[model samples]
Target: MRYVFFNHQGRAVLGVRTADGVKVLGEETLESLLERGVDLVTYGANAQGPSVEIGEQDYLPLMRKPGKIICVGLNYADHTKESPYAQPDYPTLFPRFNSSLTAHNKPLVRPKVSDTLDYEGEMAVILKSGGRHIPKDQALEHVAGYALFNEGSVRDYQFKSPQWTVGKNFDDTGAFGPDLVTADELPAGGKGLLLETRVNGKIVQSANTQDMLFDVATVISTLSEAVTLQAGDVIVSGTPAGVGFGMNPKVYLKPGDVVEVSIEGIGKLVNPVIDEA
Candidate 1:
């Protein structure tokens, strides 16, 4: 079932999209629902007031807040080729602080500090529960679901400094949602779908998840070995090539540009670019 976080009567709540419209999930966002141990069924009510419309409600980040946000870099062979260094044998991981998470359809601000803000369309896996030293075979079992991920980046900061934190963990930069879908509802793991990115309706990046250097299962398993995976933590797999920095002329985002990231069977997430005011 498709689920989204929407604002209702001055508060954020989870809603399920149905033939009747959005059925209010509960008094709070999905993160709250899980925290209170509320039955998922309780969120569904029978035709309350006029059913609220999707996109009409103010959106909160799918989880609102997560204990940790882990990300992988150059997990795609194509992205590695674009980098200025040699590819590593293992995943190059980084921590994207909670401050980076943003809701879908929101304006992604290009901070005055960085001039080369770029977009990296990616697929992310959300952990449903906590597990440590999780085996590779059981990694997929722990996933709650998937979401469309737009890894908005500051290329100048990323390449200028050795550590990626300054470039990656910017405020309201990481975009995930429309909704968090259950893993059972999607195709098995990593071999099923095409993920693409478009800027202002023009395709800038296109590739299949099957091309990922380290598939979902491998990423989860590897990361779990180092850190305990929690219920709301997100693991952004990686993005394909065709990033602005990789282009011949090096295209970057400007005010009023709309960026779209889509995954088959998951959903699409679009964000507009705005100057820091």
Candidate 2:
């Protein structure tokens, strides 16, 4: 079932799409939905309060408190080519703390520290349960779902030094969601899925997930070997080319610019750029 976290009244609430409208699950989001009960049908009756239509308002990030937001870098060949970085034989990983996550339709703060902001369209995987050293064959069992993301980056902060932590963890740099499609529900694992980034309605970058150098399964299994991925952990499967930094004359985001990241079956995540408060 497609699940989304939206503002109900003034608070974030989890919702399950229904034939009638949306079944307002509760104030708690998807994480709580899994802990309370997977069968939303059981609570559908008590959830009878008028449901808010998602498109009518802004959405919060898919998960409010994912334990970790692990990111894979240069998984796409074109991305490596654009930046002219070495192709990785294995996934190049980094940590994007949970505090950096913002929801779909939210305003992303382009901090004053950097003017060279770039957008990386990507697919993010949310972990369903805990497991360390998980085999490739069984990795799918650990995935809870998938969401689209614009892995916003500050090039100066990221490339000024080898370590990417500082540039990658800027507040609200990672914006994703609309909903998380359960792993089993997505089409052909790691196959080409269209991904695109548009700035103010103009297409900037577009590519297919099939262009990925390292597939989804490989990323999950590789990471699992070292870390016990728990429920609510999110893994961003890198992004495609067409980034601002890759353009002829770097085109970074400025205030009032709108960025949209789209993945074939997962849906689109749109966020507007805003100056830091």
Candidate 3:
């Protein structure tokens, strides 16, 4: 089942995609529903509501205030080779603040502080349930659905220090969702799906889910070993090579450029660029 969490006419509402159109599931945010222990898989598929045609939803983040946004940096091998860091055996992980998230159809701001704005398109896994040290084999069952993410970065600030949080946490840089496609609608653990990133109508990065060194299950299992993964947590899987800074000529995002992140089963997340005022 596919679900869209959006703002319609100024009020937040949840909708489930149906044959008739988008069915108004309820006004409750996905975050609240999950915190209340609603089984999204069963609830989203079975819940019925009045059919509504939402032409252009003012999209919201998959989770308005996701408890944690754990991000993996070098899951894609090629991306690592293109970077200055040497490939490591373990996943290169980081944290993103909730304030950094933006929604689909929103404009990603190119900060006035730097012109080196870069885009890293990736898939974000939303968790329904989790616990400490959850086994890798059982990790996939904890997933609720999947969404797209544009892991936008400020290149100069990113390399300012060995740590990445400063550059990665610039507000409104992470373009998140148009919809959250439930797990039952796709291959298990989101495997074998095509993930592509485009800038200004040009294909800049392309790869497959199968290319990820650390898949969903592994990342979840690995993360669970450290902290408890809650119902509303988000894990942003890393992107492939071909980022602006990695290019020889270095093509960074500028004002008026449109960026898109498309995944095979999930959907495409599109955002326009704007200069910070």
Deviating ranges (above 4 Å) for candidate 2: 34-50
Which tens-of-lDDT digit does each residue in 35-141 have in candidate 3?
78888778877877888777554778767888899999989999998899988889888999989989888889999899999999999998988899999999999
Model 2 per-residue lDDT tens digits across residues 1-277: 6678887767777877767777677786666655443543344435665655776455888888877889999888888989858887988999998788888889788998889878888998877675788888887766777888788998889997888888888898889797787665676453677888899999888888888887777888888889987777888999888899898888899999999998888888899999998
The alpha-carbon lDDT assigned to residue 170 of candidate 1 equals: 79
Steric clashes per prediction: 1, 1, 0
* Each prediction's RMSD to truth: 2.3, 2.3, 1.1
Q: Candidate 1 at 144: error in angstroms?
A: 0.6
Query: What is each predicted model's overall lDDT from 0 to 1?
Result: 0.80, 0.81, 0.89
TM-score of 1: 0.92
List where candidate 3 sits over 4 angstroms from the true fold.
none
Residues 1-277, candidate 1: write the lDDT tens digits: 5678778787777777778787775666555555444334334434254467766337777777767778889987888898776888898899887788788889888988887889999888877675778888888876767888889998888876788888897787788788777676787674668989999999999999998888888888888888877777788889999899888888999999999999998889999999888
Q: What shift in Å separates residue 219 of candidate 3 from its native position after superposition?
A: 0.6
- Against the hidden reference, what TM-scores do the models get? 0.92, 0.92, 0.97
Instruction: For model 1, state the Cα shift of residue 162 in Å.
Output: 1.6
Among all candidates shown, the one with the greatest lDDT: 3
Number of backbone clashes in candidate 1 = 1
